[model samples]
Target: MFKLCRLKYYLRNKERLIILQPLTSSLDEAFQRYSSSAADKDFLHRSILPTDHFQASLPRLPIPELEDTLKKYLECQRQILTDDEYDQTVDIVNKFKVTEGLDLQKRLIAKDKRNKHTSYIAKPWFDMYLKSRLPIVLNNNPFMYFRDDPRPEYQNQLLRSTNMIVSSLKFMKTLRANILEPDIYHLNPAKSDNMRFRKIMRMIPTPFVFYGAYMFKTLPLDMSQHKNMFNSTRIPRPGKDELVVNKEGRHLLVMRNGNFYVFDVLDASGNILEPGVIMASLHQIMQDQSPPNTEPVAVFTAEDRDVWASYREKLISLGNEETLKLIDSSIFALCFEDNKPTDPNAITRMFLHGEAGRIWFDKSLSLIMSAGGNTCVNFEHSWGDGVAVLRYFNEVFEDSTKKSVVHPSTSVQTDAASVQRLEFKLDQEMKENLQQSVKKFNSTIQSLDVHHLEYYKYTKSYVKKSGMSPDSLMQLAIQLAYYRQCKQTVATYESCSTAAFKHGRTETIRSATAETKRACTLFVDNHPAVSVEELKKAMMACSKKHGSLTRNAAMGKGFDRHLFGLKILAEEEDGRLPEMFTDSNYQKINHIILSTSTVSSPAILIGGFAPVTPNGYGVGYSTEDSRIGFNVTSYPPSTNAPNFIECVTKALDDMYEVLEGRHPAKSI
Candidate 1:
């Protein structure tokens, strides 16, 4: 590992040292960092299939130099630590650099060489999720809502659910056929997003496809995660969980009033069944008024992972093994709620972690709808992150809302035999276990608070005209809000996709920068000595710093995941933990007090996740043409979500005023 004395060399030379003799066109520091592009499918193109160029089109996720990562880590440490604490951390990090860390870094690079198909962190990342003992409910699962159906008549709960299922199955079918449009982010749509660009790409050989794409200024995101998007379930196992996927499975699973129903969405010929038949099956479940099952077996999914795993074994031993496989192998789950949500907050809660009795949390994607006629996708996060999920989310919403497969007036036929309600023969022990699961679910969901805001003061146009990245502005406001609330800075995590590379997952954009700290202090203190010019400069500085970090994280050069890989290596080695991992400073930086992500799209209304830490805040926001929206969740008393949102609103308005050079936010 390079010492602090070599920092200048690290900066001057940023080219990655690739381990494999493979694709020559792989990008290095010279390429532009990724800007996440929305999901788009082009049907008119006659050339290559959507994912045909996946292998050739993107580079592997890069590993930053050990020196670069350490420098980045130290820079962030200074933002939240005092001089004394920072000094202590520096000493610890330096010691680790020459000793255990050097060996681990070398081993990590060698392992990356041996595994050319994926990033070094891939297996460890999967193990990180699979080995967690926490329940996947509020702690791991997240929900994203679709905009309401524009044609009010289509908003009937049964009709809407039917269309979503139909659209989703269609998406699955198209995807498996490999004809669906690939997930491509066009940097300049005017140049790369049209029919002409398609023609050029069609003539190019598969080996040169990425070069062709580069000519058009488009980047293809990794489609590796898409394989698990359908016909998959997170199966609970002792000590560790596993993702069980059956691509051959074509049936649909629907949960309603604590009952489970299944029907084949695909026929023996591997074709989507008529939408009328699918809608008729859902209609049967929707019309049923059977009292909820007293045991509510599905709630077991919300129990702690190992506890649920044990119960799962009990289920299999009780002659429900076939039944369990059927549930897991289904394409996905569609849940019909007994009651309509009264408001937006209610909707957020319903989808985030619904009546545990009605949700199969293990399914890769669960389509949930309330009796009031609205829906969202609550997904298991272990198999993938936001890239694959959001793609499916956007495509399905657009297809279902604009080109629905079923309507209220469509033919209705009820066949009890068409849908199978899974029956599990449970013993007394299993039934009692069910009750325990429900109680745990209620306790966890009840302890949380959610506050959503749709601020219409400004949107994309305003941010761009002001010459700032919209996401950066949003991050700045969050830091100020936290400072305004607690009067100090803490570790902030904003997720940036590393999907631009092969088998890429996610990287962290540590949003709490020194500039943000200074800006937050200035805004909150409102000291007369701090001129408006100084405050404006600080805000601008924060925006610039945030943008740079975002780009670096997207390019797979962030410090968090690199440090994570090293820490995991240290744990696997036969020795005491490295001091770098043991340092109190390392613990503080990894706490992730403000876990935030942006879920912005025209088709999506909002998305949210529970705080990763009990006392932290889970912030989900979206920036639209008309407004910028936020949905904040926290465990109350430890953190008041409502008060934080109030502070967030003030911070946004204050920043906007500063940008406009208008009535100085309170102190002018």
Candidate 2:
């Protein structure tokens, strides 16, 4: 029996990918050698600059040929639509190509020219993300779990909690100082590459803050008081010591017992609070026996963005000014859960959409830690892509595990204020609104299904040994699995990063390629005449085609984004909906049934997203040298997640057997 592996299995087998080894004895030799070289000094001097200064100078996202886009769009639709529907789509395409689309393309070009500093499609993409009907938390946002600290001394919730907060403040300091290096792709610079990183790192705990992604109005933490750092291990017992205060909103929101609390994380002298102080304050908040909130205002975050936006305006009209500022200006949310999760699925469930009073889903990064010491982040996707969050956690993970630094004793300040609860003034009408939000949240979460699977049969090395891209092979296998189950090719959405472009997020890499369909059909048909070599060749071809599409998307020449820009301009600017967007063919292809994305981290234990559509399955996977893991989710009854997992596992095995020439051509 091929069964899914547990978190313990992953913990046992998970090996860190070490990129660099620390030098022991040659440290001075290396520095002296570098210092003696005049060329090295000159190189260092010229290479140093502000991380994101070049952001405005990067090239704008380009416009692709309209006809070629139409052709590719038709190719994608052909796999999903019926003959009559496809023909109607073809007619619509023909009409669009000769008429409004061409003029729209010209307008897009003009728009790009007018907006050289930003991508032409960036605004529309952001607006579309916010305006989309799907709730961002589970439906769109992707979350990842970092492994527990290896040091048993730091495993306690209070110690680990303070460590996470301190490390996060340190990272924020790095951002404010502009010392973090810009991210690079393909050993070359990308437009708006690091800018997205900055955006996500600073996302306010609010939805649609000022129409664009929110920037943090961060307060600084002064480290002058502590000679080294707060020791998170058992060396120093946790308790209350000194209070923390911030002038510029350097604070975190804590959601507990269906109530919200706001407090500064820095002192009056601008110094970070002692871990003991934070731990003691946390205990006080958790122990408070406040009346349980029948309806929490934060639940409004889980509502649809449009609905939330309108309701938020009503909230503003009610003049709860301080409450609004507390949510909007805070750096991020720190959600403390009362119930300790028993297993990995429970962790995912809690982190994805926690039980009542355990989540504020609107925050870009919701640092969630359960009583059992399990921790994960439920991120807001509208602000930025997953890479930014991945990078942020990488820093925190590294800082959290580093050996504790001993600091000189400092006098504790006892008179500072502790964390305070932010009470909202709600009337019967507002209470009714919040009640409706809670009902909506319950209905939505109840309808969703999540199944996390870890497949350790093979990994990236074996796929590479077969002379194929690991990512490409994984995509092909996904297509084959979907084909086996659905018995027909469906339009698939594979997120390909276009961070190579200015302010780039992602482009749709249509995974249901003609090559993939051909390969899947051949495998499923079980044609006796087909040989192992032929099957391998077809699979390799599919991978190669996917690679090409991925490259095209990376270069900002993808069909979907270009089409999206043209369509948005036609509708929003010209007040005319294009024939292509309204056609049935367009609707069929746009219905993404298999939404997939690949995110890899050396320290991350698991990562995934909720299914975008009821009938679709959202697959977030990470490929390793000896294993591959997937978190598959969908709406149950209508779409079975377990069946899809079974199909994918079977497809992987079949593909491997055929590659090794160990099994004859068999049904997938």
Candidate 3:
């Protein structure tokens, strides 16, 4: 026993030392092995390492020295050859070169190529650097870093800054490995062209992250500026304090996808026209400059609706040049019933109008003051996501209220690009063959009874017999559907279910910051995908494999591996090999099929909410041509829970009958 212990100790120590030695290597040796190889060196010298190569790249430290220092620091920390350190060093070096370095170069040229390629490395270092550096730069050099002088317009400045930030974030995320956050920020410039400073600021990080309370003092459109505050656009060296403050109300609409829609009431143009002046000016422009006899007619009351209708009817009747031109370039009226103002000082009336096409309406509290009723208006602007609609509304409202006549910074007109059209010609023979196949399938489908609901029910009951929860049962149903349709098996599948525990049902993790309360706990289960009979035999096996850890284990495994395993299992014969099953691979799949009961409630709610009453809800399934694809969402009424089993069974029968070239009715 003493001899054995000594031998074990010697082996363990030798393994430890071997791991430690490579991490303590010299910076010069590490760089030589990891950096440019002879082939890469030639490419670098010829076209990549020139001084002008990185003119547009972010300001990075000088190359060889920066690379050398990073390598030494990583070595001192005993993290040499680590993916994170190596990537950071690579990024610094690559930025100095014109062309990005090749991935295989790092593998073939590095001394510890195996370690470098073994794992993801760049994220951690980049995350740390961004968090540390961004705040400092913003605080110290906000003007120089963000400002654009040649483009005196704030909108131009905003556009330039957004592009810069996006480019920087993309580089950081790609070159680093340990990063999680994927968001960036942008500033919104106000509409006023003459106003020296744009009032509103905007920030967007993700496709869904929208937060606006982080920047600025007053709301964007504060229309209260002093005359002398406007500055020349040509000033090369404007002081940070020299920035103008336009008091006209400003509004900023921030979208999830880092775009800003800003509207300010200040006049950037020399002539600042207030609301009344702007309206009169537009009317004049319409009459004097607009095409002949295309004046807008007001439709203020129900009485006027008849007159407007008659005018339209007359235009159609005339069919002459003048009437045709008028019809072609018509301006419809936007009228409202006169009412007492909610607030005397309110400049913009908030209205909600449901236009035939898309349009904008501002719903700011200020609008409530001007219009006594809820501000609703109909205008022509296409409705999009909530973020986009909000942005458009704010822009239109601010533009209408602006005291200046400024030309739009960006052109609203879109340019059409060349389109390539492809056409394929098939002979009469091919057409006849396709038509025959379709006719045969149609006849087969018309015949099959194909009601597979009873089978589906039997499967569900069989799954329940194994003692799974309702959620787990739903997950199993989805898995079965996939298996039936795709004939594929997966090693393990995990479903994340939210479970609300009653007292004594389950233990809870305590919160360090707040008093612990009953909360939804995440449950994950990974069960082997086997036949109904096999599952029954493994009943006791379920208990050992089931628990909270299953959730973490599945997440750690990742989506790609889970999909890959499914692909592999689908290729297996009968998808069952007894010895091949392992506890680790026995995961419940990340899929769910809404049972009939589950669909009924939501379907009822949706039906109730519809403007027009719905006739009924029907559930059905359709298979895809792909080897792995999900069935359609099933509903109720025509094919609700009670009849879902019947519907799916029928669909499957129809599918098989058609595939096998038999009459579906005969199969039934």
* Order of models, best TM-score first: 1, 2, 3
TM-score for each predicted model, relative to the true structure: 0.91, 0.80, 0.19
lDDT of 2 by residue, 538-629 (tens): 98898899889988887776799888888788878878788788776677678788999887777788887887777898888888865888
lDDT of 1 by residue, 1-668 (tens): 12322433432343521222122223211111221121122121112345555456467788888888999999999999999999999898888888888888899898888988888777889899899999888889999888888899998887888788877876776677675678888999987786556544554556556655655668878888888989999999998999989987879899987899899988887777777788888888777778888878999888889898888888998899999999999999988888888777888999998776889999999988888778889999889999898888888888888777777778776652288889889998888788888888888899999998889888988998887789988998899889888988999999999988878889999999888988887888756666767877887798899889989999999999999998888788746678788888899999989999987787888999999998899999999999999999999889999899999999888878877786455632
Candidates' lDDT values, in order?
0.82, 0.68, 0.23
Error at 47, model 1, angstroms: 6.9
lDDT-sorted candidate list, best first: 1, 2, 3
Counted clashes in each candidate structure: 0, 6, 61
Better of 2 and 3 by lDDT: 2
How far off is residue 598 in model 3, in Å? 12
Candidate 2: which stretches are off by over 4 Å?
1-49, 186-247, 268-271, 287-292, 309-319, 403-417, 664-668
Highest lDDT model number:
1
Note each model's CA RMSD in angstroms. 7.7, 13.2, 27.3
Q: Output the better candidate (1/3) by lDDT.
A: 1
